[model samples]
Target: MKKTKSYKFKEVDLVSLRELALKVKNQTGFRLRYGGLLTILRTNVEEKLVHTLVQFYDPSFRCFTFQDFQLVPTLEAYSYLLDSPIAEKTPFTGPGTSLTPLYLLERSNLKTTCQDTLEDILALLIYGLILFPNLDNFVDMNAIEIFHSKNPVPTLLADTYHAIHDRTLKGRGYIFCCVPLLYRWFISHLPSSFHDNSENWSYSQRIMALTPNEVVWLTPAAQCNGHFC
Candidate 1:
């Protein structure tokens, strides 16, 4: 099977976005809705590592098949990673129109007087740019629907699976899900020893050297202990 290239969204001014997010962080229900997404946005995703990781994805099994173990992104894992609450409910059930980062950007500036509007636009930017990115600078109806549902964990996991599955089936293409989150999840499971000397080795080499016993199944961040910071 051919390895697929990792597709990352075009960069935006996250520093400004973070500043804006802080202004409204104290708003009612804002923190609950966005959780630690701002923190995750600051994560430095190693695209090469993520590309290598995707090479291990098995579409048929819907998991990353390593030497002796298989791993899949779970709702519980994402819930903990984001420090966001998750409920057992379906997300993005209804139809919606497509949006774009450009549209949200314009709205954020124009709605400076409205805290709630700014907050919604901020959430939309995070969802469209980071969480469920498909086209560059484009936020599709799916993202808007998921945002409205107020429950993103299920769809986040589903998109991760679907993106990998789609790419694997095509043999080569871009993986459109949240690459940073997936990268963080994969690294958090690595053994401590690997972390110490990881700089000297390629991601594929280091990952292939691991045994099932060497992987940390329960990461500290996954415990919802603020270790993700």
Candidate 2:
């Protein structure tokens, strides 16, 4: 029999991706598929913990959370965030760093239930990639003062995540973050798309609005924290 493609989240309902990861951790005492508790703790466990941290720091996390197969707060929210004056300045800099939503989340003390730190940083990095395509280059600019183009950043990010997944889990070359699989697992819970038209309607508009900085918006609260924890 042909085996169906599998994701980290699995096809189960009533369980968020984050909850699932935590469950895995609880059941096996670690996130890795194999033994070596310390190894799993270092990589997957740490990342999951960070996701929890960000959520705790930003109770108004709908902007980063997913909904109905799309991001929360809508693409419009992303537009508002980017169009804001702060987006133009260098992030992680004195004032500019303060402007980043990630920092805002960190300050809120929102509250999460995980034990890893590196994973949290990884999640934040991915979240940053989604929320700010030009996040890295806010200080210097050409005469045009335009942000460098990483158009279709979401697609590239997805590809990169997949590459990292294959390299780490399938190839054993390096450790990979579980967030991508975790995100995909959650996205699978959304209502399936109906129409087949590749380029038509608000759907595409909404997706284009995502940018790389907006993809994590694809993850949902249901997918992040089901009652399993």
Candidate 3:
């Protein structure tokens, strides 16, 4: 277990907070002071990560236009969308060019996560799809192990998420958390699923409403090519 200065630097929370402060201050000319600053601070922190991760790809995300969206999630609600009963958990070194959401979170015990703890860890798997259409040869390059020494961005994101996620007052379910929103965005662009539950008509309608990148991102052939997002 390495405890180098880099590890001790707490770069994850630091950078996340920095970004939160900047976002609140963005174009407002001055930071808005609120009586509920702490509550606002936590929201900013949570949304900052999600927004930063997806803004380039979706203006719906950049605008943060969802009405009922909350920054907190219940374990039951979070697991509903993320967990698969029969799926095999894939290690970072596990064979695959693309990392799916189930595989990434499957093995994580979620009891308590740490930067170097791969036996159990938490990660924001959304980056796998929204950030990279393809990891291409990520595992082959030996680029991401549990303890990512040179590139700890994944670990950082996971830790930052848990710090806020675990602490927020438990929310009703998946819709309360940002993860479901990200999934809603992704699925809006895909073909009808082989196993369709078709329950979220209103939510699906909202996601499919339209965005600047919708035309380009929804194009299956153009996914591999850049569409300015």
Candidate 4:
């Protein structure tokens, strides 16, 4: 996609269609596989506690709840949190750091779940790569962007998927993503209300040093109270 000094909001769907896809990190997708205690995470003390009302998108059952997954939202964030939070335990990166959708998901406690989502992500990648080659630049890693350009879409997707899947299964490194870049693509092509929720994504883009993408996921991460049914 072409970048302009300004973006057109009239063509954007910031509030409804793309919020879920744009806001919530890939962790929501991981819980679908593990179905265990999940920690509803927030970046700061000012954030809300979300354990109820809002639901997560599970690839298997679709939109499951805390009890359904047995998640444990932190009574408090980080220092205020209990147990060894893997999401926060990232040695390679920090909590609020923005990464590829795949990287965000890979940091999840549910590695297998993240791996499963990888296949779907690859599907999305193929679609984006074929129709919108610019999506390649927004990916989390150099190899992935290169992967999109290596061959025709159908063969490229297949070859890349198998190779990455094998690496993941064998505990090897694989491609990742950057969230803000993804948001740019979403805003330009897809219907997104990113402008409606700009404040929530402050620190997420800190390390990436890229333009801010639309975000509404901060509501649950930064506003909602945790609920266990």
lDDT of 3 by residue, 1-229 (tens): 2111111111123233223233332222221211112222233233332333232222223222223331222222222222211123442333333344344443343445332332212222222322112233122223234323223233323433443243322321121223333333334343444124365443334433445433223332224333311
**Lowest lDDT 10-residue stretch of candidate 1:** 1-10
Could you say which candidate leads in TM-score? 1
Where model 3 places Cα greater than 4 Å from the true spot, the runs are: 1-65, 68-75, 84-135, 140-181, 184-229
Give the higher-lDDT candidate: 3 or 4.
3
RMSD of 3: 19.6
TM-scores of all models?
A: 0.81, 0.19, 0.20, 0.19
lDDT of 2 at 100: 46
Screening candidate 3 with a backbone cut-off below 3 angstroms (N, C-alpha, C), the clashing residue pairs are none
Shift in Å, residue 64, candidate 4 = 33
Candidate of highest lDDT:
1
Clashes of 3: 0
**Where does candidate 1 stray beyond 4 Å?**
1-19, 22-30, 220-229
Quote the lDDT for 37 in model 1: 77
Worst 10 residues of 2 by lDDT: 137-146
Residues 21-58, candidate 2, lDDT per residue (tens digit)?
34333433332321222221222322332232223111
- C-alpha-based local distance difference test score of model 2: 0.30
What are the lDDT scores of the predictions, listed in order?
Answer: 0.75, 0.30, 0.29, 0.28
